[model samples]
Target: MILKKEHIQELKNKLLEKKEQLLKESNLSHSIIKELLTEPSYDEVDYAEVSSDSYNLNILREKQLVVLKEIEWALKKIENNTYGVCEMCDSPVGLKRLKVKPHARFCIECREAFEKEQKNSR
Candidate 1:
């Protein structure tokens, strides 16, 4: 389907919003790390002492970085007029699906398949 100008605008808006939100979150994480560094924790600050919740924080930060990369890639796809096209499959991912997951590179079926493959490979 030929993506309309309005649809492109909507996606651009969403991408911009996502990029801004990610930047804000990354900035917040940087601040937290900086603050924690300056305070000089009385206890060891290794990953072990980082607390279970903070371990999740590390995972979250890693996920955020990956999301940021995907967002940037999507922005590039928009520029190249290939947004909503699956990378693993030469299929036009439905606009409805894209609306729900703007950063998605594959449709649900393909995504699930790839995820399963990744798990198996891992």
Candidate 2:
């Protein structure tokens, strides 16, 4: 089904909001990671704790970067008038799914199959 103009605009707004939030979070994570790197640890325990925190922050930042890229791609699709279509099956990604994740690239069936394939490969 073709998405109505209003629905597309709504989804665009959601995507933009999420992108902005992620960018802000990424900046904060960077600052924390930098601080953690520059601080002097007083003992082995302290050093280990700092290292663990830094690792976790880096992982979170990496996840945010992936989502940011997806959001960018979704925004571009919106501009190209091809938003809300599944990348794998060329079907509508359903308004409910889009509302929950505006950057989703596949319909539920395709997404499940892709995930199962990924798990089997691993």
Candidate 3:
């Protein structure tokens, strides 16, 4: 089915909102890391806690970076008039799926197949 322009616009807006939120989180994570680096621990336990917190924050930031890239890709597809099309089969990704995941790169079938392939490869 052909996607309505209004629906596409709504998905675009959602993507933009999510992108902004992720960027804000990324900046906050950076500031937190900086703060963690500058603060000195008085004891070994305190130092260990700080190290753990920093490690977790870095992981979170890395995840956010991946999402940011996906959002950027989606926005670019929207600009190119290719939004909501599944990359694997060149089919509509469906409005429901797009609403749930604005950055989805594949349709449900393709996604499931891709996941199965990855699982089998492991």
lDDT of 1 by residue, 16-74 (tens): 79878986987756455333333122122223335588687887775666676677778
Alpha-carbon RMSD of each model: 9.3, 10.2, 10.6
Arranged by TM-score with the best first, the candidates are 2, 3, 1
Candidate 1 vs 2: which has more lDDT: 2
Error of 2 at 69 (Å): 0.5
Cα deviation of 17, candidate 3, in Å: 0.5
lDDT of 3 by residue, 31-104 (tens): 55334332222111112233577787877775676676677788878888888899879999998999999988
Against the correct fold, how does model 3 do in TM-score?
0.75
Model 3: how large is the Cα RMSD against the reference? Answer: 10.6
Instruction: List runs of model 1 lying over 4 Å from the truth.
Output: 28-51
Between which residue pairs do clashes occur in model 2? none
Candidate 2 stretches greater than 4 Å from native: 28-51
lDDT of 2 at 17: 94
The CA lDDT of each predicted structure is: 0.71, 0.76, 0.74
Q: Given candidate 2, what's the lDDT at residue 95?
A: 94
